[model samples]
Target: MNQPFDSDLPNIDAPAIGPPTTDPVPQPFEVKFATRVDRLPPYMFGRINNSLYQKRRAGDDVIDLGMGNPSDPPDPSVIQKLADAAADPGNHGYSKSNGISNLRREVASKYYRLYGVRLDPDTEVMSCLGSKEGFSHMCLALMGPGDTAIIPSPYFPVHMYGVILAAGNVVALDVADSEMFLRNVAYTCEHMAPTPKVLIVNYPHNPSSAVIEPEFFVEVVRLAKKYGFMVIHDFAYADVAFDGYRPPSFLAAKGAKDVGVEFTTMSKGYNMAGWRVGFCAGNSEMIRGLGTVKGYYDYGMFAAVQIAAIVALRETDTNVEKQSRIYQGRRDVLVSGLRRLGWDVTPPKAGMFVWAKVPEPWASSMSTMDFALKLLEEGNVAVSPGSGFGQGGEGFLRMSLVENEQRLRQAVRQISKCLG
Candidate 1:
């Protein structure tokens, strides 16, 4: 019987295996993703990005103003520190997931120096791969099914998706007017059952470049306390203000440490985006939760990067301020050019984007998504459509000031020729 078990099959040395072995050749099993991944909608920018890729491939000199990526290099001194630290053999190993004591201390020092907010490096401060990584993990740490978060309307993708991925719901309130936003937050908290678990605020906001005064955060703290919710301030653009406008720190509000944490990174002002040095401070317990999540997910930022980040934070304030000035200059050039095009463009007081309305016949004739495609197709210039942000951003385009003055000027010329 044992010998006969294989008798109907092909012989071990046979050149032809017994007439096609009719059980149908082994096929790959179907793959199913987790429910959380399934919950996500299709990529919002896929259409625009795909066309951009095709255009670039076709040898078109398409000027890209889509992402808020910095086009400049970090300060020379900071680069040197990175090289020097990288050269040291001791700096090549795994770093503390909570960041080194010195770097944490530096973060606390900056908090106190810039915002008059005290933070304990040992407990209140931790560095992240980047603020977005920290923010997403923080949402996971605090959220679960049935939990809810309140975010700004026309949110940056991560703001809404992070909560959604953590199995939480969102209430996005319009943030064009700060007072109205605060009123809506109170209204939602007052009207909704169980209320929201977290309230996220971004000053010098992305996509819209909305600015809020220091008093705005005081109201936010008051509402957080009244609503019994926590706060998460995305202070990504904290260092990139213009026309003497200083973005307020949520941590600067009294009792902010009781209910929240603030996230900051060197990506914008210091132009160290690719280096991925991010900081979180305030609400030590919340910081601890984020640290626990991060510990399981990552060892930490690279040791050499951390070492260099310390130097960047401690020694590059002048350079950081200089970079802001450079951005302000670029902002002026782009805003002026757009205004000349008869688009309703507001010059932002801070942040790296110019959120301009889709002008003229196009605004009524097409959606922002279509308008963006037309610009890319005809103008050879790329900009993000407002719909990419959310429903509130539907009638606008968010153009970055990342390109240099010359490229920005050229982009405007291209846009004019395309539309004129």
Candidate 2:
């Protein structure tokens, strides 16, 4: 028989004896993790991302439509402003943890101009590294043991994991039907013992590209008042939409400021994804809670970036609108191309993704993860499997609109041949 792995230890692989030696055998120490760390699952995108990297290193020109990262450049005026601000010695120092006065004011002005929701920059607004960071820190600020957050099914990963990381529980409600989603929210709140402590909303939701109308938040505010739950609306895609369909701000609803805050970012609409300029507005009390957590955790965003952000918000509205049109064109190409492949897909009204249903025999024969792998390995196209979002996302694919129209068309052809 083969020897055991511990055979090098004294008497480990030898026959047992009546008496054993008293000499100590050292054991290799292992790093331990906290219970909190144990709560998280492996990153679902790691495998796909790693494979893409490996293939690229091997010199494959993979058509990457897996991530919603913006590929376009920021307005030249914004870039010039950033360079000018960065050159000033005073702008290099640590910034105010709640963001500089002018940046917050600019965010407030945008909200009023866009949605007619007036805000006090001093008390009701703060900047974040990105909306993702703001959402996570807000979870830490507001959630705790025994707290529960109601999130949408087929969710963006952070919406679910952020609450989990704060030692809170989650209840996901399916969001495919906007009306049914609200009804389920009411039903969940009415039944849960402690009721849900928070309700997280993402209109123009990620992965699924589900968009909600303004009246949705009116019902949300009413429900929150009835059940005493706080609301956090992730409005990351606030500035990106198609077909003249403007995405409404949650705070635009009457009494919304009494129950919730909205999170918006310049990433999608401004082609400033790398700048990490994000804002949280409405509900001063909630802002204070988030600001308190941030005080200990960060030094706030870079002042130069904040200055550039101010210029973008004030002067780049046209550029933001143009970016949305570009995404609309790309969406047309991707959705039409996928539909031609006999895939069930819809053109999204807003957001940067086309949530599509996996087609026919292949979908039934293999897991979504395997199907995605097949596309990468055989078709040289990278995609995100729906199951990565949650079980509710199974049998679907979330294709991002980041690639150019030509590249997306190429991806569709490759997908066609791979399945053929």
Candidate 3:
């Protein structure tokens, strides 16, 4: 105080004035995004596709069996119906967000015919751009930061990706068998704090080609009732079974509609992959939730596509059967050819895929990706590596039966030359 002139030297003894600052301020820039996007894993198919693009550009006759994309076209009559509808300029306006009434009724009737499951078209059914779109939107509508979902491992990427995109936690169960699935669901319900709110079940499952019996849905519905969780049954491959194996709908199980919803897609069944049509049926409340989210996000698909879907559902029984037989033939050709080359593989009872365990001298030496890429380079053949599905999918590979019998046989010959 006496030497006030030396204020700069003795300032350590005085209290600091105004606000305190520790670090340098950042320069103003573009806004930061929500943290959720960073949490997403890189899309596995996109990575595989990148490689495919590069090889194809390099002039390789890449036999692409990597994706489950349908190679065939829709029925000629369906196409004509679509064209007729599109010609009606009045039909080109924004369509109903929850799907047209006739299409919804057709969805209900189809479910009743295929599974003997009755549905109120107006209350329990809603159309989706595709099942994938409905699935992801349902996740957005139902889950958030504190909610969690139980998904079977080695699942279709969307089944899990939807949960992550919703900022919900995921609990995976190894779905090798019915008993394992039941035990895992019960255990998860009992042990996990803040129990899961949703459980996703896909039969004629992707990647693994695991098929579920009707009794499995009975147990699942029972667990859902007991644990107070919702079930999202993906019945996309219902019409694609083979060898006298008819996959039943989850809604056919008693009390299933009380605690869950089922998503069915025309993509696989009617060779309408690019048509972007599907439906969700079951718990009315859940359907309403999906509808609410979808209404805000979309005005629905092209009216022409919806009209054509009606024709597909009403008149495509023989076409569906023919497509199933085509897949079965491809499956037999590929499976038998691989076995002939000394690889142990099983023929799937449903779906257009063969899940195979990595075999022999290559199994121990190469990672799944390495094995897949080597096959692509050496065999000029492309198939999905199991690791792309999830960690549980490792030590295996998935081959799609999308090719015709001749092309499939050629693929097998190519594989034999590389690995056999």
Candidate 4:
């Protein structure tokens, strides 16, 4: 052993292996993410609500009014179409990523009949797995680093998050009141960075349930033209209005096609959330942009689902009208019950959620999360806190009308008791 000893060699009889001569184990790949993703706050609402659901499963009689997931089923004809299509052996295959031509044509025809907005099915209409996916993909296709998107505050999270995911900036404008929404848009054009290349709008708005008029849309079109920004309107709840006040179509505005596109979903109107069928119509260029991006990503929705959606669009209006009536009745019941318990709640004119201001004693000390947590623990009633939408949503709560009139009344009763 001593004849030609090497300095780096370990003795043959060394009691244990010496420290391994290798670089430290590499950190997990997940530890390194895009800086943009690292900047996002944890999605607290979903995290907390999921935990609450587990608790409720453990014997609590929880009345969940938190999510806007529809509890109803599609019409008989729609279901029949899905069944019929599925029964055909030849129907099982990859679908057209841009959507079937017949489905696109049906959507265009419906648009013309309902809103008087004539769309070229082949050029301007494209189907989506869902409106959410369509909107997100559209953002990625049209926006990029250094670009800015204008979003209304208290909006659906997808609108803002999509821009962020695309590595673009968002300028949140408050649309709590109709006048304020218009004012903020005009003001944003004058003051935002990168001059805001895109503007996102929603009506029969989620959380606030605010409906915009044709005049407001005209103003939006004018701004889009002047500022050279594309307008994307999410009309998911387009057919869910009440009290005889139909929401106006952005496509109905004079210059809408010059600067705008609108998204519609079967999820809200036909209870097809699980099916995930939606369509985008308007602005041929934008539609093509979305389609091109989607083509590289997915094989499109299932053929049977697309076929069923055609039936849903053509035959489900009556079901939609009935659902709207039921929601209206529930809204009235819940509003009256809350008012009787000394909390003022205005009935929403559209959409499925009631946006209510938190009451006095807790309003001062309680953040939306705190209030929502207390409600879940103390009253066994789950509601979506306002701050989940955005900063401007603080101090408010969104109660979904997905529950029945009896369940909504029960939720109000529980809240009343908890307050006392």
Candidate 5:
């Protein structure tokens, strides 16, 4: 038996009702974000990440080779340096956004030791949260509306993302082969109206895992000087070469430092992916420009991380050699397994990826996206579809060698089953 409340009594919890007025109902608001943000392409990994999560939730063991996240841990000594620095109470203050002097000197020393490229630590070298951050900010610093930059096809997504975000136009040239790449660059330089403002290059390049000779960079520098364009060379895979191959820094070219800057990351060489430490060195102007933009955006990485990165740059040569061997071994296993199953795959000389052409059986039957999705379902193996990289990447797949060799072999076996 509940008593009814009187109608006249106040009900504080009740929603207020007012007499209808002439005002129209409030229509749902259409949110508008920056049109520059809309200009950027959708993240290509979202679908793959979602698929992997859904499959794993269903109790499936998907051998993942989708992302190039490093599998190895950094050297213990480097970690110890971080731990030691973290223990200091006074070391917790905001670090210099352009990086500490000692770390910048260490980076300069590294370039000099490895590439014979001398840089002024104070003016020409800068530290970044990672190469991606440095490169993106460099784009923001250098480019703007009505400017154009040249990017190779099947490029790292950020290459395009940075240019677009800067409101610069992108001219994507196919660099599938070395000679073709050179020819395209020359033709673009000769034919394009209003010569490009920047040219971005990567080696060992992602997805395709293409490596270039130091002589190639010499010619690139020549082209840049002639066309009056700046160059940004991403040498992130500087230490991931395989089979006695040593990747050279673009800055090693005689005139390269005059026209270009190079970005190197600790992620691949030092197995410090999550540490987010990298360096940009070469042209003083580019470094200063990026540093200016970064100053406004960040106070640099954690002091401990910067100290740890210094240790990695100064030490860790042996550790890098060991990791290279591990990636080489994984590359061997994946390449051999795929070849045995009648798929065409070339062993890459550098980088932690194998750019594989879709198997002949699936080539005619499916698009790269469809094939990638089907492989995840039937083979229980996840790979990045080539088209995810760009239009030039269509008809192929990019498989990361991030997993251990055993898992990579298992992935190949699973793919074999899918083929059957």
Candidate 6:
């Protein structure tokens, strides 16, 4: 046998690399990102708002209706709870990955009391840092490359983008009208590649503010069962509806737990956006799947935040109702004001947005981004260009009702001055 070479022998005497070559010619990285990642847009939301902010800072009085951030404060009780919990010396450590048991139990209790939806808090509920994170993780956990997720268009961009990020294809179903929305979903089930493994639905919808009724849930649950697809209902705006219209919980539908999961967040209802607290409840299997994925990724929301969220869930309904009323008042003012200026803006049924079509003079001549830029430059009104949401959202704009009624009225007045 050939003498075994001393593989471990260090070649210390080999040419003492002459003063380490100064920054060798930067070689092109041959290790490329996955094709899917390379295909993604460099930025999701464009630099429209940042540029508008700069312009506004330069003396333009921009009434920002671009983002659906709540301008109000959380309930005093909730804030006090957070403060008390934060003061506890022992609460600062890493939290449980699935969230504190107390929060989950409280969530289950609230669900049962409000929707008559019985849930085993241990298995059916998982607290999330936010509903958006919960939704995104669910898509990743339940899907793989070549899988398909049925998503409603002119809806939340995160739903579609999350599916795409998971190497899954999104079958966009336009939820423009009630009938067409349902039919599109049914059609997707009947005809789609890889047979759509997941379906995402958002009620008290963003941008559109369309509230889904119990009948819609019934149809959704039926389609889910028939097609054997997991349904993920985003109830982010569940507590934000106005005019006594209590939005129906997806769990209220019979057999909903057989194939669905619903995500609710404190961000909208309790103005806890920065707190990052939310919960997902429904089909135990889906909840477990999401929890499993999250366990691998995070240590859950902060313990104090979860404790504070428990307080919020238990005591913030009145605050939520008050916030809803405020938005409703602002919506009424903005809709009437815009209409007075000859722009037909439909008052949203729920959520914090007013989706309005671009007027005739501008609609045909300019894209949503172009019109939005022009409006920002001339009127100093910062509305979200609809095309940022999706292609179907083109020729429209989404104005958040987060501003006060006076500010909304002023925004409309500015628009009138610009357009007139």
Model 5, 62-147: lDDT tens digits are 99899899878999999999999999997899999989999999998988888888999999999999999999999999999999
lDDT of each: 0.92, 0.92, 0.90, 0.88, 0.90, 0.86
In model 5, the clashing pairs are: none
Candidate 2, after superposition: displacement of residue 383 in Å? 0.7
The residue-by-residue lDDT of candidate 1 on 1-420, one tens digit each, is: 336556568667657546763688788999999888999999999999999999999999999999999999998888998899889999888887999999999999998899898899999999999999999999999999999999998999999999999999999999999999999999999999999999998888988999988898888888888889999999999999999898989999998999899999989999989988898999999999998899899999888888888888899899989998999899999999988989898899999999999998999999999999999999999999999989999999999999999999999999999999
Worst ten in a row by lDDT for model 5: 40-49
What digit string (tens of lDDT, one per residue) describes model 3 on residues 1-420? 355566347667577697656767878888876778888877766756887889899998888898899999999999999999999998899998789999999999988888888999999999999999999999999999999999988978888889999999898888888688889899999998888999999998887988888899999999999999999998889889899999989999999999999999999969999988988999999999998999899999999899999999999989999999999989999999989888889899999899988887888999888888888888988999999989999889899988889988999899989886
Clashes of each: 0, 0, 0, 0, 0, 0
Worst 10 residues of 6 by lDDT: 39-48
Report clash pairs, candidate 1.
Answer: none
Candidate 2 lDDT, tens digit per residue, 40-139? Answer: 9998888999999999999999999899889999999999999999999999888878899999999999999999999999999999989999999999
**Candidate 2 segments whose C-alpha is farther than 4 A from its true place:** 1-26
TM-score of each: 0.94, 0.94, 0.93, 0.92, 0.94, 0.92
Estimate, for each residue in 1-420, the C-alpha lDDT of model 6 and write its tens digit.
Answer: 645568698665567667765778887779878876775775535667687769867977788899988888899898899899999988999997788999999999999888999999999999888898998898888988889988877868888788888888888777878678888888887877557898888887777787767899999889888888999999998887777788999999999999989999888878989888888999998888998899999998778888888888888777878888888899899999988877877777888889999998899988889888887888888888888888878988999988898998889888888888
The parts of candidate 1 lying over 4 Å away from their true place are 1-28
Question: Could you tell me the lDDT of residue 394 within candidate 1?
Answer: 98
TM-score of 2: 0.94
